[model samples]
Target: TQPIIVTTTTAPQQGGSGSGQQGGNGSGSGQQGGAQDLKEVLNSKVSKWGDANGDGGVDMGDVVLIMQSLANPNKYSLKDAGAFNADVSEAGGGITANDALTIQKYLLGSVTKLPESYAENIKTVTAPATTTRATTTTAKPTTTTKATTKAPSQASGQKFSVKNGQNQFKGDSDGYSYEIWLDQTGGSGSMTLGNGGTFDTEWSAQVSKGNFLARRGMDFDRTKKATDVGKITLDYAADYSASSQGNSRLCVYGWMTDPLVEYYIIEDWVNWCPQPQGGSKTVTIDGAQYEIFTLDHYGPTILDNQSRNFKQYFSVRKSKRTSGSITVSDHFKAWADAGWNIGNLTEVALNVEGWESSGKANVSKLTIDVSGGGQGGNTQQGGNTQQGGNTQQGGAQVQAGKKLCAISFDDGASAQSTSDPGYRIINALAENNMTATFFNVGSWIKTEQQIKYEYQKGMEVANHTQTHPHLGQLGSGQVRSEWEQCNSKLKSIIGAEPSHLMRLPYLESNGTVQSALYDVPLISCAIDTKDWNNASTNDIVNTIKQAAQNGSLEGAIVLCHENYATTAAAMEQVLPWLAQNGYQNVNISDMAKAHGKTLAGGQVHTRA
Candidate 1:
């Protein structure tokens, strides 16, 4: 069994041991409770197939230890077994005969529903061996000299001093005694937990106690305030030696003051490291208090990810509370885009109560960037990159998974409706079994036969604005007519109103559009194939192909209009080339799902 080590705490002062567990919790857990709202699959359940020891999960090696006490006639029963002097609750806590029956049923596949949470916090999953987080670590210095006992000194040019623990620190300290941890994808570092969750050992001196405390704001208050100060939770997975050292972790959460927001366990990390101490400062975390850690150790994926050039999905935070791995939907660009922009905010939000439940006011900070309407040559919105979750479409050979992409003909509209080139491209896509999104023109639906063929054959007939003008330049009412006219034409033929899904002529729109769209997500390209840029046909295909090769545009959102014949000429190579190179051409809908964007109410929207 892994050792259950606990974090040490300050005794009303730095390097001191106060008492029982801390009063509050981490900041990350509160962030994670929102996870339940964001997920499709639950990560909290244990794997039914992971009974490696062939024992029911709740059974023991540990709890059901026994010896036969035969009472003659070779007929022995557990009825007369000598019981330990523990209470009835302790005896009942051990495994029972009914537990065996449950496992037996589980293996038969009769077990359908999973429990609400994991058996115990969460276990560490060694991520796919193909993509290792650790590179070969340099060996520790070999010729070592005997060292003398002394106080734990901070590293040179050190920003903070260690109060009570030994070399290296981990976890947040409660006013009492506890340690929260951090994610360890970066690499290994020193920790603060001692043996068996106990911190009763003596420090070389009285000034070495430690804790990790940080402050975060609430949306309602926006006044830049501190939150519930508390210790983080840790789950040590694998043990390295007799000392029980293996994987170390921590959980962060949002805390509330006043009546107090019930704390939830948020995301946890396998390895937590120290932050740099350049412009370091202190803030109280909870009412009892804690020392907050900030930008020094902030290693969010978005802070470094680049958009268009880099695309991805996300995995679960690996903890007790999570339902399953979360894909921060392609529509939801946070760590990728949001994180980059958040770095520029000058003011911080204050901790407001009741935010843990309903907090739409907080997102107002985001609305400041939305343009009223009109424009789309280059983004005035600044290039921040996509959100960070897990890298998508992985290959043992490449960095991420097979990227989902699409090629739409928009032949139904555009001036080139009755052309031979676009028709030729359609045949090519069909022959290739390329599942494509085909947004139609109002004029094409007038051809009753072709309109029936498109809607019936599973080609997605989303709207491309009726007149195909820059809707951004139009007034809100005109934008409504643009969508309504297109919707009317499509409804006349397809017999159903369109969802008003669109890919702008210039692939443009503005903040003013929300009034027209019930809730349609705007489509934007991550990596435009750029075929319309007056570049040669080969240049367009080559640009995309080269991006796939150089591993830069792995999750590219290449845009091409079937309205052009050059795109048709290049289709032959583009499709086959991406496949030969191992790219998976999924529709926009699937890509959105993989990224964990919200699907409608039983109305799964398809946009590739």
Candidate 2:
């Protein structure tokens, strides 16, 4: 059991030692005291699943109680078994901020159940009788420590103050050491490196609220082949103010000496860097998703007069998790499979990089498990050797000799149809195992949940103007307003901005419209179903069938309206025909990628 300290202001009553004392009623029955004792015992047992106050429910109130205890350990207490219940981590250690985060994740629906121990203990506990108590109030505890600590000192010119022992490099503060001497922005924090021998190192840090507290962990030798070094695992706990507007990250860093490239696997919140080359692909490892990116560095210098020519690879986690273990080798394998020549490993490090943020983090363990011997194979040289393979396919490349087609529905959630055309269209596409793009009108969105359902079902929800206006005639301001309103609505509904693909009303676009769009790509279809004109279902089907036979449908973006019942009827046949004809029905984004193109800002795209 963890230690529990209880503080009281009033002195204990005389003649009562761990026994019942006479109250204002002047009565102290032995049976009444026994019942009270039983209630306390039951409360202690019931509190073991994040119910810190023993109120029989794990909610925000319990979270607040735990925070209070952390803030003032002496004045406030977990009280009996509250500490055990609060240990939500799998480690089953004492209560920490990670336990609070686990409870938060449970409340947020990210996690469906508490830790295993909490469930196991709750199943065996028995309930106690309830009792009513007289009203009483206690004074608030005095503030001994501020909720936020002051930023650390930053007069030290180094990124982090280093204390170099015989075989150790320890950091005295959280700082940054850039290859180029950029203007310094001052901030303060502290970190430590332990077991800092020549080959092994451990790092931990507590960053008091500040701005741009970027620091690197100690570097480990990376002279051996990657296969020989089986895996590197990082066990860590991190917490930051959710209200903070800046970015904070904990990531593993690898540097290759030959190509002078750096690879980073990062878990970040808010903070970001420019990826001029853009993201390549997303890979899932250990059930966590990561977005990979590569970029060439164009800096003035590389660590004080070193070469500035280098490349960078970043694998950023899709979601922020406060506590977990990362298998570094799996990420490397993903990049290697994607044609990234990782080259010979030279230095490996874990870093806590922060920018304009206030937070704290702890790394409990860092272990590198090595297996196998160096096979004595010649090291693959050059920066571009690993840049082959199926990297393009991992993003959106279509197989050679295979044609790509995109099916798109416009003006979604229309009120004209007898049934939900969006639902029916999605069902047809899903049955065929295909994905399409939907251009939604903001006003037509009856409920955000409907849009969420479409997005969740693997359909791309894009912007069609707020009221489906003709951008060719609308002024620049109106065009911006129309695009912004629709994008904002989609973001609010689906928790992300719509894919930067928009279609002009009636396909009416001009230079003015194009300039107004700025960065958003204009999506024009290769084949027009003309279902908006109330074409017969057979006519719609025949148009697509003829296009496919004539080879016009190959690498084509087909346009149909979700508001029309004929379009939905047409897709019931068109999707199966495309699948049968050796065509892969993909979204516009995928189709663009298949053709070695990006569906990004300022580009007008049409099907081949």
Candidate 3:
């Protein structure tokens, strides 16, 4: 570097003394530098060293100020500083021109393109050292625990239950758990937990109608043949009497062709008239004794036509069964008549469209007088001729032994009247907490919400044929279609077929509709009130008042449509009037049982 500077100071053309000359201290170099004017110009254009604000010159504290701003950006105002002075702003934070120069210098071997590469020489050197140190470390282990749980098994049996689990459904473990009691023995028995009581969970003591059931997991197999079961020795005399007049008790005993959940019925006659009063039969299964005490399935539904809720009560005095014969002994026979088959309904009731498979009946404090319509008595607009009454010129049929009664209402569920007087009548009924049988049209039950609302409100949706036609009048195919469609629709909308009762469109029929009821019960009315013809309120009330008195018409099944607002209004007068009288309301289901009933044409899984 020094040699080059010396050469520039002593150029011979400048006429100044050369560096090698005696006066070459270079003070006289100014004379020779006069020709090189470019040198001065070049010095003037160089970048300022410390002018951090980029005004092209270095200041006293540029570097220090840049460092201070980098440490605390808030201390320096971006607007007052240029890129050179603002470290964050100029370097884009920490980037700078020097960094780029360093990278470029590394890529070029000598930082300035190998120093023009005229001539270059490189040297190598090395250094080494040896050292050692050691230490030990320990690690911790992990721990974990796991838990296991077991699920309980369900009990088996075909059973019936109630929501409350108290009255009307005591001594039965219906809801506290899931179970179905099948092939149940009719005789008395008891169960006591002994030793550890072979069950997975704690056992709940159980009893039913004085009979006991062993808990699940017990060694006594689930499918026990009760054909040889002992008798349910009941003290009949304690609660039963023979010579009782109007308020006699009747014990019902029957063996199911198949396992059953409950005895169901269709016609109001079956429900109202315990007409099938008294008789007994025995079946010998494997020489074991099985007895069925059935009343005549005829009477009120047959020749008499008098609809009466007649139930005969019997107490079990003794029962004994051998492997060869299961014998049942009871005395529910009270009335003068007795028959095992209630025979075909037509043979029994003379004018019955046909036989109604099963039915109901009840004996209570207040006697009831049912019109063709259940409690739906009072009004229907027939014509100007019969404006004051709900009666037609039909023969007396239904007979009620009890003094109290309630009528069932139909047509209230039709789309046309769901909210009119039909609706108001229901509201009125609700005001009194009254209940009635409402045979619904299949078409109306199109949604789940509708069915749920009706059920929650305590209104029963029974089958009124797919359409409102006299079922007996349709062809066999049409009849089958009617029941099938209604059943399917009801199942979809209501979750199950209430399948309790069915009414013929006109108490009119042929053999076709009859056969379709293998799983549905038949509900034949006790009387023909012909409200569809528009019987008047006064006529309805008066006819019902007489029905309560007349023998054949005592338990008459009343029929009424909801097309007119008059029916709902009329019920107000009739129902309160019945309550004021000796009449009491009875569920249609209970009424049908008196007739030995069940769903006729089909069966369904009653359990989930």
- Deviation in angstroms for 568 in model 3? 1.0
What lDDT score belongs to each candidate, Candidate 1 first? 0.31, 0.51, 0.30
Which candidate achieves the best lDDT against the true structure?
A: 2
lDDT of 2 by residue, 296-355 (tens): 876422122123577787888888665677777687678778887765453344555555
Question: For candidate 1, lDDT tens digit of each residue in 105-124?
Answer: 33345644322122232112
TM-score to true structure, per model: 0.35, 0.37, 0.35
Ranking by lDDT: 2, 1, 3
Query: Could you tell me which 10 consecutive residues in candidate 2 have the lowest summed lDDT?
Result: 128-137
The weakest ten consecutive residues by lDDT in model 3 span 127-136
Candidate scoring better on lDDT of 1 and 2? 2
Q: Flag regions of model 3 displaced more than 4 Å.
A: 1-406, 415-419, 444-451, 473-477, 549-554, 593-608
Report the lDDT tens digits of candidate 3 across residue range 428-468: 55555444556666765444554455555555556667776
> Model 2, 142: alpha-carbon shift in Å?
63
